[model samples]
Target chain A: MIQISVDEQACNGCGLCVKDCPMNVFEMGSGVSIPRRPENCMGCLSCHEICPAQALEHQGVVPSRRMYISSRVCSMLNRVI
Target chain B: MTKSFIEESQQNFQHDLMFRVEDVPLKCNPPAAELEQTLHGLMQMNGYIIRSLEEIAGRGANAVTFRAGKKFGHEVAKYFQKKDNVEEALRELSYILYGQYSFEPWKPADKDHYIVEENGSTFIYLVFHDCIVRQTLRRIGQEQSGPLCQTLCGYVVGAIEEITGRRAKLEIVHTGPNACLKKVILK
Candidate 1:
């Protein structure tokens, strides 16, 4: 239920994703990161954090909670904008 | 006033600690926003305390938090009816331990085969998407997987121990900005 994409142009073929993914979801394919075992991906987005080029993308995954955003920052923004 | 990102993140939390005190005398209880803000602060403070304890005590912090977490875990266990079946209890426990929006269970593609077995140990993988500790660390620009994480591990083991009367452990598989993977080992 998760779809992963790699931006070929954006990808530097660092293989960091392949190395970082606990599920072994990515594999280096001809100097490009490929979702070789996408089904294994648990949508932890560990690849996203490791990829320096920001080439990986995932769809159909639940978004993380952002309600923890600082109240001070929000209160300041409420007054400014 | 325009809605802030805080409100957008949690629609019910429409205001960031804004209070309406234009009432007769004063209210016995605090406003909903105040209660919510207090909870947010409490969670953040938990993180801060862990980090501070770590700085002062190093590995000693883990022991302190672990004991506290286990105690809290037992306290939480009192609320739930103990199930005779281990798997059934775990299924129920997941509802409380892994919240709907925060920590979520990561099931394999094989829906029927939900629980994974490796090296003769049964495991349930949980993917934490919205962890308060993670948020707190990010707020202070501190790295993740510190001693605070051990508290959660202890909590899980403690809860399972109380509920099922079986010793268990929580293993941190991996961590990331968006999500983290934790494995609950059934012993």
Candidate 2:
């Protein structure tokens, strides 16, 4: 089981994580990002791949925890991805 | 709007942590009781979010507004988060600023100017009219609203003050092709 944590400080309220999660693990409030379906996260790492702010992290997982690029970098890395 | 959003966040996300960075003498600064009146007055002017434990930096200060986590651009690059990404963003941002890279806005008129100051420690993006318009690639997440802008500005200003140990100012010049200005004086 992966424990997902969303860093409020780093989140710029972009809402991309809310959309990228296939499990519907994230929610959007006004402009901020919130974790709604954390349990639903299948460890697919889709949200991890799409997160632009590097705000979301999986704590419980062992070795090689997954991370994602921020939205700002997404614009730059879109071509490579 | 920034102020309102902060309030809403505090009320809604009771579990989440909120931080405010302010530039005031570490100890010489007035106590919260004294600053309350000033903060209250500033609140009336729109877009003010003051949280407890506003880390006060002392003396002359000016620097970059560094933000990490999910919402800011750092998540994308993870440079600051990972040191290497910071170097890369600086390289790209620098190249673009010096007219070396071909990175230009899709709309010629909607040019978003990026400013790198304090030896690349601070990156200031003067996103003008174009930022006000939402992009097709991002529909639900585009930062087009006024409140978000104000909040971003306030947060940046506060963070800059904290990072540099002084008050920071951001000037939003109305240089849009179709722009109108209304001036108000604080008496």
Candidate 2 chain B has its poorest 10 consecutive residues by lDDT at B178-187
Q: Give TM per candidate.
A: 0.76, 0.23
**Candidate 2 deviant stretches above 4 angstroms:** A62-81, B1-187
For all candidates in order, state the fraction of native interface contacts they contain. 0.68, 0.00
Worst 10 residues of 1 chain B by lDDT: B95-104
TM-score of chain B of 2: 0.23
lDDT by residue (A1-81, candidate 2, tens digit) is: 457887888888878777655346689876768776565443435466567888878755322111111344566798788
Q: Which candidate number would show the highest lDDT if scored against the true structure?
A: 1
What tens digits encode model 1's per-residue C-alpha lDDT throughout B2-101? 9888877788745676456784655747775567667667767876777789999988888888787788787887678777565787766776576532
lDDT of each: 0.77, 0.39
- Where does candidate 1 clash, by residue pair? none
For residues B57-101, what per-residue lDDT tens digits would candidate 2 score against the true structure? 211111112221112332222232222232243344333223211
